[model samples]
Target: MSQPLTGVKVLDFSTLLPGPLCSLLLAEAGAEVIKFERPGQGDEMRSYEPKVDDDSANFVLLNRGKLSVAIDLKSPEALSQLLPLIREADVLIEQFRPGVMDRLGLGYAALAEVNPRLVYCSITGFGQHGPRASEAAHDLNYVAASGMLSLTAGNDGAPVLPPALIADIAGGTYPAMINILLALRQRDQTGRGVHLDVAMADNLFTFQYWGLGNGALGDWPAPASGLVTGGTPRYQVYRTADGAFLAAAPLEDKFWDNFVALVGQDANALAKMSPHRAIEAVAAAIALHPVAYWEDRFAGQDVCTSRVVSLEEARHEPHFQARGLFDRSVTTAAGGTLPALPVPVDAAFRRPDRSAASPALGAHNQLLNR
Candidate 1:
């Protein structure tokens, strides 16, 4: 199979999650991603916990199939060495605060002068020029700023921390990848690159399209009061006898009826009860059975009810295995291997290799000497 990004070259200066993941997708599609890291420490994520050999598991996973070059950008001779690569690079990704790159003489304008067709992408928390651009924040702060956290409330009405870095991946990485592709497309026609400003917080509003619509009509949803949040009995979580939870989302009348029948509850009575009362009744009924019992009862039923499974359980699920989501693996130099982090790229667009290893720190620093 032919990968889409066969000859494309990427200069990855971003650390942590968003930019690294975006480039990982590109690398999977056959791009040559050359990562620039600080000489000694490399990307900060390399020091993160759960080491596989010398690098962190996260670093190993994200930097897979990429080349690494270690150099001190602050050194006077840095730009001279980078200019050769920059002049030929098709893309560059950075996640520094707005002016940090400019100060380091590696901003879009500086690099564009060298390679007019370079797709320079900057991923930031707020944005390049927003009021909060220079302010420090993380994934949680971005979601909170976007009002997404406000919708994720528990029974006590306090916002719960999200399980994953929603803002980092959903808001930053995906958008950066999309826009970089778009910018590359534009370059194909225009013969000139464009600066892409990807603000994680700004992009988060798209995830709240429904909430935005409600807010526009002055019917803004309060904490856990929205349909998908925790509003109706048809869309809530119920705990089982063994302290496990079931995610129930039989919203339509047909599915609700099926769920009611399967749970041995009166559909009409549930419809008559207050939303809170209905939720309580459903919870009480579910509490009568263990997760396995409910899982068996809901099997092959269109009630849209399922037990909340653990990560390990989900990874070992037969459906995902059948789909070959974990068929590919990331191997370490020491020969330890784990399932590659599943990416959104289609199978036809990805490399066919079943296993690949992430680069050791400065493993490809020889490229810089060229």
Candidate 2:
């Protein structure tokens, strides 16, 4: 089966999670992604912890199936070398702050002039023209600025750090991928490309649609008071006797009834209790059993209850293994194999072989001469 993006060419100039992850999705869908990195030092993510084959596991995981071309963009000869690649690329995605690309003379305007059908995407914290466009922020800051952090407050009323990079992946990567594909379709019709401004902070507002809708009405729910956020015992995490956590989200009445019966709680009492007391009641019941006990109790129960496994445990999960989620592996320079990180692309679109690995710095420097 031919992949959907088999003929598409992508030039990725982004670092860290958002842009690389976006390009990874594109690559998985069969785009020829060329990751442009700095001359000596590569993406900063290469230095992150939990190294594999002397490279950050994160870097290897996100950058597989992409070629690396190293160059000093600040040098006078940069444009002459890059223009050819830009001209051939169907898409160019970067994660620099506003005006940074313009300063380097690799801005969308310049690149688009050379390749009229290029879908130039710029991913930033705020946006190209926003008041905080130039502000420095990471995943946490972007989520905080988007009001998501306020909704994630713990019992002590302090915001808890999210377990995932929701802002980076959801805000930046997913939007960039969607918009770039949309732009490609548009280009097919008009024979002209578009410059996409993917603002991570701005995109996050959509995740609060329910809360925003409530605020627009006369009654505004306080942070952490929404039904999904912790306003009800049906949707919350409970600690097990073994100190592990169980994510209990039996929101529907049927599922909730099952959970109530299994935990030996009165359904009517739980349904009428204050949110605080309801949570306490669930917590108390859950604390009486170890995670393994609860796991056995809830197996095939349709109660929407599951153990909160660690990353290591998740890697070896039976369900995921049965689904063949980790069927592919990328080989390292030292001939070691690490599982290829899964992307959402359909199996028919994925590469049949997974020999593609994260490249060494300037590994494809010869491409510049060509």
Candidate 3:
């Protein structure tokens, strides 16, 4: 496909979501992604939720547009084949624990000897230097440790995990992509590669911008109490008559006033009412109408109120569709096409980025030699 990364090569030693997802983006943009796997067992995500003929949708979705290389990292013959391939790689990403790669003699320092221009990326729970870097954790664990978990609430009224893999995919993928790009830019100037030690926990901490700021000011020390959290009634979710949902996030006074007016309530009273009372009023009023009734009433009002759409509904959202969010397609290893989600890129960045199919298991055994 036509893409800016057409000539780029990526060695992905990561499994599951984050690392796979990072390479998937590069591969989509025409980079040749080589996914390394164990001899028999592959990425655990292959059997995770939503199986289609024993292949996980999660795996299929993130792993398209890459080639797979399966070999036992412990085998001398396999190691031999891998070294030469590593020598020619532009970027190398690994999600193993801090010492795993080093034990296998495939660490950043060792690999860089063969390819001085290789960008080596290491993904872990905490970091290469932190005390908790050795701990084993999942998305929720990382979220909890990073303080982002306190920002979320559950139906049971306790801090809970978000439905998505926010820590792994968002934090890890964002760190990988951004640093890789930065390293690529630096390579142009220095003619050498760099190592990126991306701690998923630290990366996930970026979500706590306002809370962190609050802490620095010695105010709002409690989590979820800051302006951007659940502190303002203007930024809360209200229910509709049919038990559907509506969200109002107009933190500004003007939009908050408009939201109250749209609900046929006393705008001034709402602003003055106790948070509990105001939330109750908004909730009660919203329960008086079906989603459609309020949707029409609020239409063209430029209010921040909106229906809380589901994933399926979001897939068909007119706004996103019109904006070409999911406009492109990615070719699959099975010679098929699937919807490609458009990433946010600068409008001034004029580069052709396209999607290709994810690599099948061990699909590139012969293409890359060690």
Candidate 4:
């Protein structure tokens, strides 16, 4: 079957994580994603560490199956060269500050006049016309500004650094793709394109639904003191006897009963204890046994628990292997291939080619001449 975005055309002018990841999803969904990189240097991610060939694995992983057009957007003749592509493009994604694209004469207003049906998407730390629209910030700042960083705390009551770039991917890339798809759908009816203003910091509030609800009712959640946080014995990471961690979340009564019973505690009696006392009790019981013992105990039980595994261990997980999440491959310039980054895009919407490579800088520069 043909992919969902087979006929869509995308012009990606964003680099690094957010915009590139959005366009990567588009490319995987069969959109012809043509990435416009700066001449000579190309994307900054190409220079990042952990190299696969001459370029970083980060760049190739996010940009596979996409075309590249290297051009000097600062040149006087750049607008003329880009006009043809702009006129034929269905979507344009950029990550510059608010007025940067307008200064280059490539903003949504100018391009929409050329192709009225173009969906222009701008991804940034702050949306256009906001108080902090022009602020220079990264993923960490975005998460901190959105009140998400305050919710996670270490044992000493200090906030912990998030393991992943949540704001960049969850707040920026995912929202941009959703809004871009929405804009495309709207364009089919109105025959006119729209501009999408996606702010990474702004989009993060959606992830804190419970926090928002509680805050509005004059009861804000303290750090590590929420239901899904480390507030309850039912939802916590407990250390096993062998120094391994097991993430436990037997939240519901039924699951909690089964969990307490399996942990060799009286479920009814433990349920009556104070939250902290219950937590201490559970922790003590779990500390007597190793991770392997609990893993076997919880294997077929209704308890919602899992032993924490390293990234390397997760790669070899039986469930993920059965799901074929790592089946697709990405080829490097040196002809070495590795498992592709597993994305959330569905199989039916992805390209048929399982093995694909990222473009060399300006590899499709012939399109500029056309």
Candidate with best TM-score? 4
Residue pairs clashing in model 4 are none
Q: 80-99, model 3: which lDDT tens digit per residue?
A: 77877787789999999889
lDDT of 3 at 192: 97
Mind giving the per-residue lDDT tens digits that candidate 1 earns over 204-283?
Answer: 99988998999899999887578888878899988999999999999999999999999999999987988889888988
Stretches of candidate 2 exceeding 4 Å from the true structure: none
Model 2: per-residue lDDT, tens digit, 265-318? 998887688888988998999999899999999999989988887888998999
Candidate 4: tens digits of C-alpha lDDT, residues 1-370: 8888999999999999999999999999999999999999999999999988878989989998999999989999999999999999999999999999999999999898999999999999989987999999999999999989988876788888999999999999999999999998999899999999999999999999999999999989887678987889999999999999999999999999899999999887876898788889999999999999999999999999999999999999999999999999998767767789999999988999999998889989999888
Q: Is candidate 1 or candidate 2 better by lDDT?
A: 1
- Alpha carbon lDDT of residue 24, candidate 1? 99
Between candidates 3 and 4, the TM-score winner? 4
**C-alpha lDDT of candidate 4 relative to the true structure:** 0.93
Candidates 1 and 3, the one with greater TM-score = 1
Note the clash tally of each candidate: 0, 0, 11, 0
Lowest-lDDT window of 10 residues in candidate 1?
Answer: 330-339
Clashing pairs in 2: none
Candidate 4 deviation (Cα RMSD): 1.0
